[model samples]
Target: MNKKYNIMLLLLLIIISPISYTYNNDFIIRTSVDMKYAFCDVKTNGVSGANNRSSVSRGGIGFGSTSTNSMILMENGENTITIELASLNWFSQDDIPQKERNIFHPNARCEIVVNKMDDQGNIIPLTQLMVKINEDGQPEAYENNKIDSSIEKKIILASNTEKIESDKILERVNAKEYPKDMTVFQFNKKINISDLPKWPWVEADKYEDTPKQRELLQAAYLELWTAFEQQDDSKIKQLLTPSLEVWAASTGGNVEEQFASREIGESFSKQNFQMIPINWNNFQPLIMNNGKMVKLVYKEDFDFSPVSYRFTTEKGTSRVAYHSPIFSFVNGKFIPVI
Candidate 1:
């Protein structure tokens, strides 16, 4: 009897199997305002010779998003990443210039050092990694390289104030993903200040310039800080959102000043607030938990702008912002809601 020798191939496992990485939020946004609505004043240098390109895209951070002062990822396995949001940087394509030709591309590149931890909380080796989530409910790191990451690995939303420098992967996104006409989350429609509507909190009230209000506050805040170093009442009032009347009345806004002494009146005098109109867009009257009539929606940012207010005395110049803070309007006043 002749028996044939059986040959078998054994596969070896390397690195680790089923590597899981989680994020803190749906998508990572850099805004100059608060946390929840990190949709404005984004830092995007990644756009290819286009002002309309966004900084954050499908695979990674956009061109303008990267910078020397960007955040770094230092992990030891199962760690949480904190990414700050900038001002009203995020907007529909129409708001940005040359958007028709420029596409959305997040030049994603970063190195995540996941340190494994022991039961005692000591740093160990690779156990798992993760990225944060975003407002869109979409997670980073595509499956099957569909979105095209240079490296095929578990991806997640990663946020930081510093630029994430990585050679692990590269990703790309085109105009198809971001439709030009998509309505911005909280910003007013594309229109000049001349077309601004009057303040309208309720449906039957009156339409207003939503973007203008935000811009006015930003500019007025700068003027108040610049003129008196914190004592400019007119600017304080002009910058105050109609809905924020309560907060302004209660805390006496402009008492503390913008961030610190560096943010002063000289920083805002040339802004020409005369042309700025009140921003009144999406905000509407809604009942609060206590049945109190209040506008529940106000959009804020989560990151700082790479390039902020230039403090120019020139007319018809771009207005710089401090941060985006989603506010809740109640009784014709603005109440900042994180």
Candidate 2:
């Protein structure tokens, strides 16, 4: 009789206790592109995340120009990853010698590997996709390349972080920026008023030319720059999407902790620096996810935007640091998506 009662209690415990699920909150995208005279960009789940443009222009081998970046898996179901490569018009702005231009036709070889983190923190590759650009600068499948706009996959999350609600997300994304009266300085230089264009100055994928939308986008970028200059991780996190927050938490502690760990701002504060405003001249709108999201791309590189800082070392050498603060338009307001 005692044994029977104990078994019943065990069954009751099993039934009454909540079932725990590991939801994958983050994944890593490894991108490699070899281009003779072209550039490539990688977009996962409609968000442009990584690219190979920076390496290509620096006169590197341009082979094995790779980047590994962590991205948030927003949900536990199907997610789409799309990568596109385009040829560059190297001599579009300037007249070049025919021999220089004839040396290499615009072509690139690109590969992308998507991997998910298991509960044990091991990287398990989900899929591998590759593409090659022909001499004519058109994308062609390479080695089982079934590149499609709807390349979907089901992902199982391994993290227990609770997803924030959409309303709360909207609140965070729409948080007010620091007032103009606030003194924001970078490298001991006060940031002057932003000169970002309010209208579509260059041709792009799409444009929503509305007074309200433009104002919100401008404000979003200003807030982003302000947060970076102040090194306010909490404020910066407030500007990012909840998915990005989850990605930060999954990798380390939280967004603030992750930013603190990098110490990028602290290092910059120690040096003399010059601020490079957003490349307004190259700003172009990229509509993604069937118009559900939008990204302001610069020179076709989605990861190179918003603003940059040029830090000078004691030896008079300098390196420019680019910040990728992505945003999406939701409910008629702009919010940072990454």
Candidate 3:
């Protein structure tokens, strides 16, 4: 009987060993940056996360900064990592003086730290990486004034060791997955905005929705939707803020020297917007930024791809999600702020 009991215990250990290791293998990424005005995007193994953006500000308007954390799953092998940092003040060239812009100057610094949690829940630091604009010439880093300063590093993470490309030993770290049998809905067909049903509004304790506010907000949304369906760049521009325009241009590679030259409509077309569908039922009105802006968000978990937007692609399946270009209610009109 004692021999049988010992054999049962050994079988249990064999079944549980792999599960315990897999549960604790994930790495946590903490990113922080200090600058007058800045934005940072960090990615692990081609998956983007830990993104943080500060409000655009001028001299009297004050400074901008960000600090955020994300968790990354690893495969016990070499992993690709990338970081992009941009000075927000550089985009506000018209409002901010050139001397004050300080694009990629020595004063600004961004840092990324990787850590892992043990079975006992204690945080163990693996490694830390820092990027100073002054260090743009580093072998693993590069700078593009038109886009943003970026760094690419490869790391081999295993059960016993963490190794980075530069021979440094240290720590660390979805594109959301779509369903296999998802139905693809074509968005090319035009639908009258008035015929759509009213989407429910998400209640915010701090903000109240009045009839007049609702009317103006709905009107703005309809106008933008109409412009999007018609592919009218001029109309879209009238509704979007100058700051957002600058951001669009910065993200769109070396397309044009000036932001005005990059047509937003053409960019949308290149992204295969026709494959996406406009599902009114999935949208919810969300008041944000101290009630200054109204953003349409997905009611379910607020992801770029909410299951309903999945579509077929050459690579198998993809999701086309819409969330941003949050509208600010100003001067009795709704304008896209970000």
Per-residue lDDT over 1-338 for candidate 2, one digit per residue giving the tens place of the 0 to 100 score: 00000111000000001212233334333333333444445665455455544444343324554544423312233445555443333322344443343233444556676555545668766566666654554555444544444333221221111223321111121011111111111010011111111111111223364666656676766666666677655554444435334344445465455444544445347467555565444555556544545555444333334555556556665544555544556434465444
Q: Give the winner by lDDT.
A: 2
| Ranked candidates (TM-score, high to low) | 2, 3, 1
Taking all chains together, each candidate's TM-score versus the true structure is 0.27, 0.55, 0.34
RMSD to the true structure for each prediction, in A, is 22.4, 19.6, 26.3
Which regions of candidate 3 deviate over 4 angstroms? 1-207, 244-272, 275-281, 304-312
Clashing pairs in 2: 22-157, 23-157, 23-158, 24-157, 24-158
Off by over 4 Å in 1: 1-264, 271-275, 279-323, 329-334
Tell me the whole-model lDDT of each prediction, alpha carbons only: 0.26, 0.41, 0.35
Q: Which ten residues in a row have the lowest lDDT in candidate 1?
A: 5-14
lDDT digits (tens) for residues 171-216 of candidate 3 = 1111011111212111011111111111111111223467676666
lDDT of 1 by residue, 157-227 (tens): 22212122331011212332233333231111111111112222221212143665445334432342343
TM accuracy, model 2 = 0.55
Q: How many backbone collisions does model 3 have?
A: 3
Whole-structure CA lDDT of model 2? 0.41
Best by TM-score: 2
Global CA lDDT computed for model 3: 0.35
